[model samples]
Structure formats: C-alpha cells, structure tokens
Target chain A: EAGVAQSPRYKIIEKRQSVAFWCNPISGHATLYWYQQILGQGPKLLIQFQNNGVVDDSQLPKDRFSAERLKGVDSTLKIQPAKLEDSAVYLCASSLGTGNGYTFGSGTRLTVV
Target chain B: AQSVTQPDIHITVSEGASLELRCNYSYGATPYLFWYVQSPGQGLQLLLKYFSGDTLVQGIKGFEAEFKRSQSSFNLRKPSVHWSDAAEYFCAVGEGGNTPLVFGKGTRLSVIA
Candidate 1:
C-alpha cells in the first residue's frame, strides 16, 4: 500500500511569517499524527487525530499553531508568526491504531529565518 | 510524566561489525516502547516495538531490540552493520492504548567501510 504523503518537501520563511503544511495519510488508516523534529532532536508530537476528531494536542502552541483533519482523511498544520526555533522537519504519520506501528511520510523541512 | 532518553548522540562502527544503540524511558505505568529509523531527508520508520510479550522483538532490515522492564530500557541491536544502516534512530514511549508518543532526541549511526 502507499505510505503517507506530504507536500512541499522543503520550506523557508522569515520569522513572524505564516506557513502551512499538508499531509495525506494512508488509506484505511484510522490514526494520524503530526510531529516536529528539530535538528539533533527527536520528533515531538504536535497533534494526533482519530478519524475527524482530535485525540491529543497538549504540546501544540495554541497561540500560533493549529491542526485539523477534516472528513477523517487529509490533514493540515499551520503556524502563524513562525519563529526561528520552529526551523525543523515536520513529519506526518498514520497508523491503523495505537497498537500498530506507524508509517511516515518524507516530511517537510521548514526553515524560519 | 513519560519521557525517553537516547544517551548517545552519535555512534560510529565499521561495516560487518556488531552494533548497539541505547535507549531509556521514564513512565508511571507499564510503557509501550518502540524504535524507529530515519534516513537522511526521509521520515521515521518503525524498526521494532515492545508491548507486553517477549522482551526481544525483531524488526525489518536485520534490526532487533530488547526491552528490559527492570532497567526501563529498550536498546536496538544489529548483529552485523552495513553502510546503509547509517541513519538517525529514535526511541519512543507511549501510555494508554493509543496515546501520543514521547520520543528521545535520537542517535545518529555512522558506518565506516
């Protein structure tokens, strides 16, 4: 089966600029996740979606970051007024459920100057 | 709180030699452990996982990991290293059945011919 798909493999933006990333999960997968992986750091979970509803987003910066999975299929993550610290690779993954291993996309590498 | 730690930031090994990467986690309950590998400019891929059964779990590409509940560790091992094995490896922990994963910084493996 096809793996998760993401758009704009790379992005560069100035600090305080707005940016958005898109993710298309695998077919028949019930769980979708977005993670931020900074250089020399592990991928951090930004949000998780089970179907069209959010399961967890405690780590998300509500003031500037927002994510949504509409129709229980495709998802999008947006960061307004980006910061230098936001420079990292944003990865999208999908799983059948929490019990199964995840399949990930190539990711979108974002650089905020 | 749940957290993961990959003690080694990087490791170097010669091709055909054995390899091992360390991972430790802290959590309140019985944790679900996982190991993932990420190649340059690629997304994370599941290498192995440990939920409840055997401590030793085999993964794709000649990888395996042993979960030690006593030490709260899950270390990845490969009997013979290959040049293609050079990549970043991440360890993650999860609580509940399908909760968001908590990940460690990662260990970058360098293989020499």
Candidate 2:
C-alpha cells in the first residue's frame, strides 16, 4: 500500500508572498493532521481534520494560516503574507482512526525570505 | 496541557554499542506515549507506542521503549546500534483518541563505525 503523499517537497517564497502545500492521505484513512516543524523544535500541530470537518485548529495562526480537507480526502495548507519565521517543514499525516498510529508524508520544506 | 521533552539534542554511539534516548512527559492524567523516527528528507515513521498494559513496548528495527508511569518518562533504547540508525527520534504524548500529539524537539542519533 502506498503511504501518505505530499507535493512540492521544497518551496522558497519571499515575505508577504503566499504559499500553499498539498497532501493526499492514505486511502480510507479518516483522520488527517497538519504540523509545523521549526528548526531545532518539535512538530507542532497546526490543524486536524476528521473527514471534511475540522476537529481541532487551536494552534493554527488563523490570521495568516488556513487549511482545508475537501471531500474527506485531499488537503491543502496555505499561508498568506508569509513571514521569515514561517520557514520550516510542514508535515501531513493520517490515521485509520482517532487513536491509531499515523502514517506521515515526506513533508514540504518552505523557506520564506 | 500535555507536553513532551527530549533532554538530549544529539547522541553519538559506535556500531554494536547500546543506545538510549531519554523522554519525559507532563500530563494531568494517564497519557498515551509514542516514539517516531525520521530519516533525512523523509517522513516520520512510527516506531512504537504505549497506551496501557505492559510498560515495555517493542517496535520496528530492533527498537524498544519502557514507559515509567511513576517518573512520567518513556525512554527509547536499543541493545545495539547500527549505521542505518542514524536519524532523528521524537517522543510524543496524547490524551487518547482524536487528540493531537504533543511532541519533543527530537534527538538526533549518530552512529560511527
């Protein structure tokens, strides 16, 4: 079986520019999550989705960040007016259920100048 | 709020030597623990998890972890190290099903011949 898939393994953008990352979770997985991993730091949860509905996004920077999982399958995370501090790896993961182990994607490395 | 801490930022060991990576968690109640490994430019892979029952858990690639409830710690260990084991390892804690994982900054392992 194939693992979770993510696009644009690497991206470079300037401050104030917009950037988006795409993720296609494993088939049949019901839980999807997006995480931000800054250098020398752990991966922090940004948002979580159960099917097409959001389950949690408490840590998401709502003013600048947004994510969507349409049709309960593919997902996209966007950042507008990106900041230099936003330069980090964005990871996507999926689980069969709420408490199961997750399968993660290779992640997108975003560098905001 | 739940949080995880990986005390060591980096660890080095020679092949065939034993290895241990420390992890500590802070949570109000019983928390689910997990260990994940990530290779350079790759995604995070689940190594093992501890929910209940046996405190000692075995994972893939000869990895094992012991969960000490009294100390609020879950430390990963391996009897012998290999060159391929060089990677970053993360420890995480969660409330249970549907909850986002709180992760540690991670410990980078270096194996020398």
Candidate 3:
C-alpha cells in the first residue's frame, strides 16, 4: 500500500511569514491528523479530522495555526505569521479507524528565521 | 486528559545485545497503545500496537512490545540490537474514534559494535 504523502520536504521562512504544508492520506482511510514535533520534544497533536469534520483542535493555536481536510481526503496545515517557535517538523498521519495503528508521512520541516 | 511518558531520553547498547524502551501512559478507559520509530529526518513508522486480546504484540523489524495494565506501561523490546536499530522511538496512546493519539517525547537508541 502507498504510504501517507507530504509535500515540501523542507521549508524556510522568516518570522511572521506564512507557510503551508500539504498531506495526502492513505487510500480509504477515514481519519487524518496533524502534529507538530519540536526539537527534543514529543509530537503534539495539532488537529484531527474524521472524514472532513473536525474532531479535535483544542491544542491548535487558532490564532496562528489552521488546518483543513476538505472532501475528507487531503489535508493542509497553514501557519500564518509564523513565529520563530513554530520551526519544527509537521507530521501527517492517517488510520483506517480506531483499534488500528497509524501510518505517518515523511513530514514537512519548517525553519523560521 | 491523556499523556505519555518515555523516561529515557537516550540509550546506547552494543550490537547483538537486548534492548528495551520504556513507555508509560495515563488514560481513564481501556487504552490503545502504539510504538513508533523515527529515523533522523524521517517520518514515524509503526513498530507495534496493543488494542486487546494479547499483552505482547510483535511488530516489523523484529520488534515487540508488552502491555502491562497494572504498570500503565507498554515497553518495546528487541532481542538483538542492530546498527540499523539506532533511531528515536515513541510511545503513544489513543481513544477509539474521534480522539487523536498522545505521544511521548521519544527515546533515542544508539547501537555500538
């Protein structure tokens, strides 16, 4: 099976700039997730979508980070006015459903200068 | 709220030696557990998962994990460490449907000959 796909293996932008990352989940998967992994830290859940409808975004910084999984297939995560602290690897993952392990994409590495 | 903890930040072992990565999770209900491995500049790959039925679950690359309810732990084990096994390992917990997985900080394993 094809793995989850992500675009822009790496990105570099100045602080306060805007950046976007794209993700394509495995075929037929119903759940998509976005996570931010900082250096020396665990990956934190940024948002979750269950077939286009948001299931969770409480941890997302709504003022700066936004995510959408339109048509319940592909997802995009955007960080507007990106902070210096926003420099990290953004990972996308998908699963068949509950009780199954997730398949992760190669992630987008963002560097804010 | 759900959280995961990987007590070891890094570990080094001689090649062909046994290895163990500890993971502890906090959740109220019956929890779904997972172990993932990430090489540098790469995405996460599922090592194994525990939903139910068996306490010990085997995964790819000769990895296995044991889930202990009383310990609130799911520790990954490998009988013979190889140089390729040097990577970061993460432990995660998730609820069934809508909830996203909560990940640990990850343990970095270094293999020496």
User: Which pairs of residues collide in model 1?
Assistant: none
lDDT of 2 by residue, A8-78 (tens): 99999999999999999999999999999998888999999999999999999999999999999999999
Residue lDDT tens for model 1, A1-113:
88899998999999999999999999999899999998989999999999999988989999999999999999999999899999999999998865687889999999999
TM-score of each: 0.96, 0.98, 0.97
True contacts kept of each: 0.72, 0.78, 0.76
lDDT of 3 at A91: 95
Residue B107, candidate 3: C-alpha displacement in angstroms:
0.2
Query: Can you tell me the CAPRI class of model 3?
Result: medium
State the lDDT of candidate 1 residue by residue for B47-76, as single tens digits.
Answer: 988888889999999999998889999999
Worst 10 residues of 3 chain A by lDDT: A95-104
Model 3, residue pairs in steric clash: none
Candidate 2 RMSD computed on C-alpha atoms after optimal superposition onto the true structure:
0.9
What is the DockQ score of candidate 1, to 2 decimals?
0.76
lDDT of 2 by residue, B26-98 (tens): 9988888999999999989999998888999999999999999899999999999999999999999988888
User: Which CAPRI level is candidate 1?
Assistant: medium
Per-residue lDDT, model 3, residue A49, is 91
- Candidate 2, residue A16: lDDT: 99
TM-score of chain A for candidate 3? Answer: 0.98
User: What overall lDDT goes with each candidate model?
Assistant: 0.93, 0.94, 0.93
